[model samples]
Target: MADWASLPAELVRRIAHCLLYSNDLDCYMDFRAVCPNWRSATDDPNNSTKLRFRPFRWIVVDEVSETHSRLLINTFSGRVIRKDLPLLSKYFVVAATLGGFFVLANKEPPHPAVVLTPFTGHMIRYKAAVPSYVDISGAALSGPFTGNCYEQYKAVPDSDSFALDFDDEEWGRTFVSMRLAVASGMCAFDNWQTTVAVPPLPLSLVPKISYLMRLYAIDPDKMFSDKPVTAFADLPGTGDANHLFLVASDDGEVFAIIKLQQHLKVFWLDNDNRSEEVEPVKSIGDRAIFIGYRRCISVSANKFLSIVANSAYYVKSTDSSLAIYKYDLEEEKEERVSEAIDSLNQGRLSFAKPPFTIVQLLSSYTVNVRESQLLEMEKLKRQQLPSVPVVRGH
Candidate 1:
C-alpha cells in the first residue's frame, strides 16, 4: 500500500496551496487538519507567501456570536463560508470597507478593535479601540491596507471632528451632526487617499439652498493653503440637506448624494480637481447605492430581478422605528425596499455604541441564508479532513 501519511513535503505543500486566480487566498484552513505532515508543510496564513487581498464579497447573516464563529454569505453566489475566528468572538462587526475587511470592535473595558479578513483568518491589531461611548458607522482606507500584525495600529480618533483615521483606516463615527461614509465597489484602494479632504473652516450655509458648493482640496493637509475660506457661499439648490452619503461605483465614479425630505441630489465628485465646485449628475448606469448604516457600498444590480438597478438604499433610525429606504436615481423618486433584507438588522444596526447589540451562542455555529441554503461549515470541514486527530500535549 502507498504511504499516504508520508507524502513528499513538496507534494503535500503544493497540493494544499490552492490559489484563487493566483492573486488571492483560497480554502486555506482545510489543509491544516489534513494530517501532521500536511500541516507541517503548509505556511501559516499570516506569514504565507500565497496570501493576497482577493476582495471577496460577503454579507453577515442573521446574527453574529459574541465570539469564536460566524456565518458569511457570498454577495454574488450566495454560497456560505463559516469562519471559526476566536479573535472575533468578543467583537462586533462595527464597520466594513470595499477592501473586503471587517473592522471588529468591543465596547467593554478592554475596548479592543482589530481588522479581520473573515475568510482567510488574517488578523491585524488596531492602534485604537472603539470608545465605549462613540459608535463607529463605517470605515474607508487611504491606500492599499497592510494593517500591521505588531502592536495595535496607530489610530487617531478625532475628538473635534467626526472623522477617525487609524493609519490608512478611516473609521466613520456615527454621532456627529454631519456623517461621511466612503466605499467603492471597484479597486478604489489605489487612489482613496486623495478623496478624504475636509475644508478647514466650518461649511457656510448657502442661505436657504440645500446644495453645498465647495472648492476644497482633496487632501485635508492642504487646508492652510487658500481655498476653504470662501467655499460654501457660491452654492446651489435649496434648504438644508437632511443627510449626505457617498459611494464609488465599479468604474471609479465617486458621488456625493444629499437627501432633503424625499428628494436626493447626486453630485459627481472629481477626485483629481484640487478645489472645484461639484455639479449634479443625471445618470449612474445600472448600479445600486447603499448608505447610512453600519456600512455603505455600491454594487451592480443589473442581474437581479427584484433589486432595482440605478437606485439607492439607506437605513434611517427615527424615534419610533428603524426603516430602510430605496430611491430611484433616474426618476428621483423613492421606491420600496426588499423584505428579504428587512429582517437582517437584529438590533445590530443602531445609532448608539459601546453597547451595540451582542449575543452568545454555542462554540459551534452554522448558517447559510438569503438567496441560497443555510450550510454548515462543519459539513465543509468533514468533507475536507480525512479524520480528526486526538493528539495531546501542546
Candidate 2:
C-alpha cells in the first residue's frame, strides 16, 4: 500500500480544501491532528479566506449577574470559552454583529456607537446623531438611522425646527409608522452613516399585484441620492409589511421571506433586466436562516445538522427565547423543528447584551495572544529552531 502518512503535501492540501468546503470542521481538525506534516498542509481556519463557514460558537453575555464576564459558547461542542471585555462591559451596549465585528453604542452621554472586532481589537467609532431617539438599523459599519424629526434641524440648526412639536395626530401617526418600519428589517445600510430606505408603498388606486417586491442598488459614495437603480418583481402572493424579512445568503443571493402567522413563503430574487421576478423557492439548498431583532444570518446547514435546512430560526421581539420552524417546500407546511432549542443549549441560555446579536468567534484577532508572555517565548523559539529540509513528493 502507498504510504498515506507521507502523501504529497499538495495532495493533502487539496484534501483539506475539500473538507473545509464541506463545512466539516470536526473532520478537518481531526485530519490536522494526525501529524505535523498534515497540520502544516492545511490552512488555519482563522486565516483562511476561502473558509466562510459560520462559527460553531458565539460570544454571548452571561445573564447571571454573579458572572459579569462574557461566555463564548460553541453550539456544536457545547464548549464555553470565558473572557472579560472591560471596554464592552463598562461603556457600551452591543447592538449588532456584522462581518465578524460587534456594533456597540456608548451607554452613557454623547452615545457614540462603534464597530469593534473583538478578536482583532480594531474599532471604528461614529459621531452620535443630533437626535437622541433615532432608531439605528442595519450593521454598525453599514446601516441607516431613521427619525424624520432630525430632518428639519439639518438645514437650519438654530431655527424653531428643533423645538418639540407633536400636536398633529396625522404627523404623529406617520412618524410612528416609519419608526415601526425601521424596527422591522425594512432598512438597509449603504455605509456607516447613510441608510437606503425601502421603496414607498403603492397606492390603493394602482392595480392589485399578487406579489410586489422591489430592489434598490445603493451608492456608498453619495450620502443621499434622489434616484437609485430600482427593479421590481411579482411574488407568488401578497405579503404584509409586518411579516416580511429580506435576507442575503452567504453567496450574496437576496431572499424575501414572508411569515403568515405560522406559515412561511420564500421567494428568491431573479434579477434580470428583461424580466425581474421573485421565484418561489422550495429549498435554500444547503442553507438555514436565523432571524432576530439584531440581524438575520444565512448559514450552511450541512455543518450544523442540529439546525434543519429550509427553516427559519427566529426570536420574537417581545420574547427572549429562540425558536425554530421548518418549512416544507413540497407540502407547503410549516412545523416546529424537533428539540431545536434544546439542541442549541442544554441549560439556561445566556443571551447577548441588549440588541442580542449573534457574532462568530474569530481566532485571528484575539487580544489574549497579543498580551501574553507566550508570544515572546514563541519568538525566541523561532529564532533558535533550525529549519527543516524540504522534501519533494514523488
Candidate 3:
C-alpha cells in the first residue's frame, strides 16, 4: 500500500478543502490531526474571523425556551446536533446572516449585541451611541478577518469593546438617503471593518423593486464616484422589502428570492456593468437555498446527499406555530421537513458561557476571553454605570 502521510501537499490540501466544502467540519478537523504534515497543509480560522472554506452552516436560537435547543444542523446532510447552551439563555438571535455570522442581543435591560461566529467560539460586542437603542443591521464586516497574521483581531479579555457613530458628510458623511441610512443602521466594531454599504435607491425603483440587499462586492467608496452608478438592477415586479433575500451561489452567481402569499420566486441577477440585468428563474437545478430572518445562502446539493436540490428552506412562522419548511422550485410547492430541529453531540457544550457550538475548529488566533471570564466583566460594566441622582423637590 502507498504511504498516506507522504502524499503530495497539494493533494492533501485538496482533500481538506473537499471536507470543508461539504460542511463536514468535524471530519476536516480529524483529517488535519492525523499528522503534522497534513495539518500544515490546511488553514485554520480564528473563531471570529471569516476565512475561505470555513464551515459555518450551523444555527443557534437567540433565547432558550427549552433545555435542549437545536444547536447545529447540516443543511446539506440533514444531520442535526442539538444541545442546550446555558449561556445563550440571556441572549436572543436577532439575525442569522451568511457565513454563520449571527447578530445576538441581550434579553435583559440595556440591550447590547454580540455578533458571534458560534463554531469559532468568538463574539464581538458593539457599543452603539444611539440613544436608548442599538441598530444591529446595515453594514458589518464584509468577510471574516483574513490575513497572514491572527494577532490583529485578538479581543481583550474583559474591557474589549467596540464603538459606533453617525455624522455629517462634512466629516465622512456619505451621499445617501439619511432616512434609509438611519432606518437600517450599521454596527461595525472599532477593530473589525466593513467593505459594503447600503446606497440610497432612486425614485424610479420604489414601485418596481425592493430595497437593495446588502452583500459584499459593492464598493462603499463608489458612493463618491464621478460616473453614474446603477446601484442595483431592478426586477420587473415589486417585492416586499421584508420578504426579499439575496444569496450568492457556489459558482458566485447571485440569486434574489421573493416570498409571496403562496410560493417563492427566484431570479438570476447578472453583474455586467454595461447591461446590468435581472432574469426570472424557474429552478435552482443542483443546489439548495437557505433563508433566515433577513439573510439567504445557497449551497451545492451534490456536496451532501441529503439536501434536496432545486429547493429552498425557510421559516414558516405565525402567531401560534413556527417551523422550517422546504420550498421545492421544480415542484412549485412547500413542505415542512420533519424534525428540522433535532440533536447530535451533547458533551461539546459549556454551560459556563455559550459553547456557541461544540464542533471546535483548530485556529492559531488566541481566544483572549472565554464567556466564563466575561461574566464578571459584564457585572463590572453594570457597576461602573453612572448613577443619576434626583434633586430634592421644594
Model 3, 142-214: lDDT tens digits are 2211111111121222433433334444223222322122112222232332212212222222212233333
Highest-scoring model, TM-score: 3
Candidate 3 regions exceeding 4 Å error are: 1-11, 23-25, 39-50, 53-70, 74-98, 101-242, 273-276, 292-294, 302-307, 317-326, 331-394
lDDT of 1 by residue, 1-394 (tens): 6565778888777766543222223343444444468757766668443223344444443342334465554433324456676765556555444434666655353455566776666777654555434333223431111111111122533332223333432222111212232222322134323312111111221111123423211222221111211121113452232444456554445677665556677887665554445668867787666554223455456544445667776543332333445778788887544211222234544222222211110000011111101122224546898777998998
Give the winner by TM-score: 1 or 2: 1
The lDDT of each candidate is: 0.41, 0.40, 0.43
Clashes of each: 13, 2, 7
Q: Write one digit per residue (lDDT tens) for candidate 2, span 63-152.
A: 323333555543323334555556666544434333234555555555555556444356766563223443333221322222133222
Native RMSD of candidate 2 (Å): 19.4
Candidate order by lDDT, decreasing, is 3, 1, 2
Q: What residue runs in model 2 are displaced by over 4 Å at the alpha carbon?
A: 1-83, 105-113, 125-132, 139-242, 292-294, 315-324, 337-394
What global local distance difference test value does model 2 have?
Answer: 0.40
Instruction: Give residue 331's lDDT in candidate 1 (0 to 100).
Output: 84
